[model samples]
Target: MNNEVNGDGPDSCGIRILGETRDLTVVNNRIGNAPKGQQHIGILIGEKSDRIELRENELSGNLDRKIEDRREEKLWPVQIRR
Candidate 1:
């Protein structure tokens, strides 16, 4: 919580939840907005991740989609899911 993230890469993101990550919570953060011409994403939930929560986050000015969940079976958020 209370973080501001920025990165530069083809797959760069403000926050990235990858691999077998589970039972996690992300809240009250500001994500994305890389320098001009940089590829930046706000939140990236990877394919194998699960049981994650994102709450009250502010995502803006990303080069791509604000939040990208690449899970084959998408889940909803009373909290959030990968």
Candidate 2:
């Protein structure tokens, strides 16, 4: 596992992986502008986790509008069930 997270506060979240288990590798990090209360996820994989690999990371300006109004009122109608 390799990790490097550069920050620009506002409750920075360059990486957040939760639960379960698997092979993991996250490389080359530069995540920016991630704050808007609670869970600010530049990378948050938490649906009972699985094999994970995020490489060559360079995520910029999370475009925080209170995190898009709390992810449009809690991730509404967005279906992408693995």
Candidate 3:
């Protein structure tokens, strides 16, 4: 199966994390195939969010991908592996 997201603006990503969310893991998934004219992302970690883990995942065929800590503070660690 193909994972798709057809939309614009914030939270219109294949994976999204926001607020004070932390200690989370996103692993072993196939994320792709966004609509032709939309703002889609491979992964997104929003403002004030931290400690996110993205491991052994495949991200392709998308629009925009801004994957990281949006905030300047990180108490733990974020891991992204393939």
Model 1 ranges off by over 4 Å: 1-7, 75-82
Ranking by lDDT: 1, 3, 2
For candidate 1, write residues 1-82 as lDDT tens digits: 3334344666777778899888789988766574554646777889888777888887776457777788887664426422
TM-score of 3: 0.74
Q: What TM-score, over all chains together, does every model reach? A: 0.73, 0.28, 0.74
For model 3, name the residue pairs that clash. none
Q: What would the per-residue lDDT of candidate 3 be over residues 1-82, giving only the tens digit for each residue?
A: 3554446664477777877887888889877654644545667777777778889887776556646356676666678788
Residue 8 of model 2, lDDT score: 45
Worst 10 residues of 2 by lDDT: 65-74
- The list of candidate 2 runs beyond 4 A from truth reads 1-31, 34-39, 59-82
Assess candidate 1 and give its lDDT: 0.70
For candidate 1, the TM-score is: 0.73
RMSD per candidate (Å) reads 4.2, 12.3, 2.4
lDDT of each: 0.70, 0.47, 0.68
